[model samples]
Target: MLSTAARQAHILAKSRVPAANFGLAARRFASSQVQNEASKEDKATAVPSPEDLAKASHLPHISNVEMPNKDINLKNKLEKPDYEKEGYQVPEWKKAFGETFVSLFHIDMDNVRAGTIGGSKYYYMCKDQGLQFTDEELSETAVFWYDTLGLPRTFAMWFQITTLHVWLLFVRMRAMPFKMGKNYQQKLVDKLFKDIEMRLSEEMNVLSGQIRDSYMKDFHSQMLGMIFSLDEAFAQKSDDVLAAAVWRNVFNGDKNIDIVKLEAVVRYIRMQLYVLDSISDRAFGFGDFEFVGPNETVDLLTAEDKAQLLKMTKMKFEPEDGKTLPSQKSKLSLDE
Candidate 1:
C-alpha cells in the first residue's frame, strides 16, 4: 500500500495533471499542514501581542537583545560595567591620578596587582572614576583611606594599606606613651605618617599584591613589623578595650563615626584630622614653634582660635582706638 502511494506520487512528477506538479504540490501540502498545526496551536494558546512576537523573532539572536525595561535591568547597571564591548580604558592621566592620590594616602596601588592588566587595574581604573567615601570622609573624621585611596574598584585596598600604616604608627606611639609619653610619641607618629607619604611618592604606581609580595624584604619587614606589631596589640586588646582606647574622644561626642569597622574606621577618622590640620597649616604659614610633632598636639584650634592665631602671626595689632600703628609699635593705651 505504501509502495502504491509512492508510485502515484512519482507519477505526479510529470506535471501534466494538476496533481502531477510534484514539487509545487508538495510545497502546497506542507504549507497546508503547517497552517493546520498553527491553527490548532492558536486555538489552544492565547493570541500573542506584537511585543511578544518581536521578542520571539529576536529570541535566538543574542547579538541584539532589546533593553528589557529599566526595572528589570537594574541589577546589571548596579553591577560591573560591560567591558567587553564598552571598553574599560585606563587613561594615562587617570593612572597618574591614582598614583598621585595613592601617594597622598600612602599606598602605591598602581604597583598593586588584582590579577591582570584588565583585571584589578582595569577594575580600579573605573572605580577611581566615581568613587565615593562614607560619611566619615565628608566629616574629615578618620584616616578616610576609603575616600582617599580605596578607589571604588578595590574598596578593601585603600583600607588595608591605610589601616596598616596607622596601626604601625599606633604601636610605635603606644609603647612610647609609657616610656616617652603621649607628647613625645605623638610627634614621632606625625613624622612616621609623613615618611609614609614619602614612600607613596616614591612608589605609588606599583601593582596590587606587588607590595605585599616584596614586603618580606629588609626595609619592608621593618615597616611591616611596625604595622604588624600595632595590629597585634590592637588584637590583644578586648573589643571593648580597643574601641574605648581609640574612639573614646570621638564617640558619643558632638562628632561620632559609624562604628561598623571599628579599627580601620577609627584610623580613617584620624587620617582625616591629619588632613584637616595640613590644610590649616597650608592656609596659614606657621612658625616652626607652632608646628609641633605629628601626634604631640593638634592646633585643634577652634575656628575663632585659628583666626586669632593667623591674625597674631601677621603682626597686625590694633590699639584701643584701632588707628594706624607707628613704625615700631602701637600702644593700646593711646588716647582716641
Candidate 2:
C-alpha cells in the first residue's frame, strides 16, 4: 500500500538483518573451529612437570633404579695385579749380557724377557716345556680336529689348537696362588704370542711388516673375544654353553657342525683340565707336565684310574741322588 520507493527500502532493511545474523553465525562457527584446533594443539604438546612425570604409569619406579659408582677409588679397587712386582729385578750387568747374547743368536727377545724373572735359573722354561703333549697325543688330537671339525693342517689350524691348549693351561694357572699364577700365565701367553709371530714370518712367509702388524692386531682381537667367550662358558659350567662357544670361535660358526663331535671336544677339555688341576704346582711351573695320551679316554677314567694315571705320569725331578748338574744358569753364564 506504500509507495514503490518506500516498499523497496523496507525490503532492503529486512534483508540487512538476515545478512547480519548470517555473518554473526559464521563468525561464531569460525571462532568455535579455531578454539577446537587450539585445544588439540595444547593437548598434543603438553609437558608434565617432574612430579607429574614421576606419577606417570609408563615410567620405571625411581626406587628400582641402580646407578654405578662414579668414584675413581671404587673403580680401582676391583683391579688385580697381573704379575709379581718383587723378585724380578736382575743386576744391570747380567741383564745387559743376557740381552746381548739373545740378540747375537737372533733369538726372540720377547720370549726370553717374558720367561725371565730376575735371576731365575730357568729362563725360557715355558718355551722349553713346549705344551707337554706327546707325539701320539698331538697326532691323535690333530686327527680329531681335522676329521671332526674339518680343519686343515695349516698355520690357522695350528694357531687354533695351540690357543686352545694354552687356554686350558691358563684356566689351571688361575687356580694357583695369585703371584705365581699371574707370572706363569704371562710367561706362557708371551711365549705363545712370540712364537706365533715368529712362525708367521719364518714358516708362513708372512714377511711384510705391515701385513704382519695387521694380522697381529686381528689375532689380538680374536684372542680377546675367544677369552671372553671361554670365560663366560666356563663360568656357567654348562656343556651347551661351552659347545656353543667352541662352535662359534673354533669352528668359525659352521652351520653344519656335528653336535656329537662338539660334545667330544667339551669332554676332552673337561678331562684335560681335570688332569692339569691334579698336577703339582712345582711340576707345572718347572715344565715337567705332560698331557694324557690321545688313546686314553679321559671321560671314562674313574677317580681311582685318574689317581693311578697321575702316579704313572708323575715326572721324576730327582737329579740322580742329588748330583749338581749344569743348570740353565750355567748355560747363560757360559754364553756370557
lDDT of each: 0.30, 0.46
Model 2: pairs clashing at backbone N, Cα or C within 3 Å? none
- Candidate 1 regions exceeding 4 Å error are 1-219, 233-237, 240-336
lDDT of 2 by residue, 1-336 (tens): 111211111111111111110112222322343343335554454332212222232311112112122235532432222333324666788767866676567664323432544112222322222222222233444544543344444455456666676676677667655665676677677656766676566545679989998888888777778878877877766667877888887767878665655655565565455445545543445443444433232222345733543443332433446552222211111000
* lDDT for each residue of candidate 1 in 38-151, tens digit (9 for 90 to 100): 345433443222122222331121121211122324334334444333367867887677656765665422122212222322232222322223321222212132232211
* TM-score of every candidate relative to the true structure: 0.18, 0.51
How many clashes does the backbone of model 1 have?
Answer: 26
- Candidate 2: TM-score? 0.51
Model 1 scores worst on lDDT over the 10 consecutive residues at 284-293
- Candidate 1 differs from the real structure by a C-alpha RMSD in angstroms, to one decimal, of 35.2
Report the C-alpha displacement of residue 91, candidate 2, in angstroms.
27
